[model samples]
Target: MSTTLTLSTFDAPARPLNIPLPIDPPEGGWTWPPTSVTLIAGENDAVLIDTLPTVEDAADLADWIEASGKRLTHIFITHGHIDHYLGTAPLKARFPDVKVVSTAATAGIIAEEQKTKRDTTTYSAIFADDLVEEVVIPEALPADGRFDLEGHDIIGVSAGQSDTSESSYAWVPELSAVVVGDIAYNDVHAALIETTTPETRKGWIATLEEIQGRNPQVVVASHRKADAVNDAGALAKTIEYVELGDKLLSTDPRPTLAEFVARMVEANPTRANVTTAIYSGAVQGLR
Candidate 1:
């Protein structure tokens, strides 16, 4: 029997920690919201982590920032995925002074993808026409360093490799919190990897361990609720998911992608999207 887990309400004083972004391609029957964006407020200024998947959601976040009476000093792009970065242009418009930041690798990918979409009309049709015109690539930030903002230090960690050459993680020491993009997913699902290697996965596991060692009281994931992370529990669950994918890949007469996905769903019915994402990642890895 599958059990339902209810998340407690997350209320923070400075700004709303986790704001659910409406999921697109809504026919997938995904349980939890597909994307989550976080706002980390300091004494003087605030930082907005990954914008949502849509313009409306990004506007909502901007409205919330305006209401908080804190200037949005910076906007952090966790990765280069469309769902995470596509809504940034509007957000930037709302806070014109806020510096949009991302890792060098992610910045390059964003620019390259934007150019490709413009060059090939075939792929351009995949995105909404309005969105294509509004897309704005963010400036690149140092991969591994700390930035002083509003009397608080924001640390950036280039944890491991992903679709982009480097994945950036943001850590706020004062809050004992970290905004980990796709590096660590919460109760949702892993993202489909455009580029990932076995060695990279191992390195990602190590990075997770390092983050856990910091004893952060709160962890804001890119796609799930922002709350306290049971380090051991979350990491263990990720290990299990990755191990299952490895097992499925090692089958002598390898199962078809659809078959493997079906098996995963059967094994963990409650985590439907997560199972599907894992299967998708594994299939991509095989290719």
Candidate 2:
């Protein structure tokens, strides 16, 4: 069964707009629904913001793209996270000629992670046991800059780090759209565990501000439904989430990171994963 969610575009000075791609995790051991893949249509070609988490999801997206009748010339990967990139192989297989764009750092990280995951017995057992022997590695990452797609341009920006060291961002000037990956999330709390320092959060905020400064018509986040945050509300929420993490880190001299996360979760029940990540990072720091 499939589900759909509609996100309305906001009217602001920048003219931000977005249509949310419905994604839910799969059942029985698989992360359900699926990550939303935003489609940014330019004058000539279309750019796929991010790939879903599985082959099935990628196939679904390909079907949608085919139905739209628009040429998908580029696939932009926001980061190296498995949830954001695992579906890439299928997409590449389907569109053998489309360029897969990302940062050099991100490409290296993805290649390393894919290699490690395929070789490690523990990782394979837990995540890919069903297809441990059928693992597929990705092709080379596109070099940074504007890649020609048919007659249009797809730009990959090395926007700097966020939750992960290799995080990257993409921009399409013609479409007035920016695919921010996990740099900016709406409604859901920010993931802090993957981030090493408050500096990383600051960098993320700075990047978002820069994107907004560009006044794009649409901004596509890696997770959550995509919508235009023309005003300050969505941005404010993002800042608030980061501030909350900082605040939690300030108080409580707890030694055990898990305990600290539990406390934070107690205070903010809605931010379970965010709290857990913060706790994990704190624990790692102590060690």
Candidate 1 similarity to native, TM-score: 0.75
Per-residue lDDT over 169-229 for candidate 2, one digit per residue giving the tens place of the 0 to 100 score: 6666655666677776644445676655667767767766776787776666555433434
lDDT of 1 at 111: 90
- Measured against the true structure, the TM-scores of the candidates, in listed sequence, are 0.75, 0.69
Q: Which residue pairs of candidate 1 clash? A: none
* Candidate 1, poorest ten consecutive residues by summed lDDT: 1-10
* lDDT agreement with native, every candidate: 0.59, 0.55
Task: Give the per-residue lDDT digits (tens) of candidate 1, residues 105-125.
Answer: 777867986777643333234
**Model 2, global lDDT:** 0.55
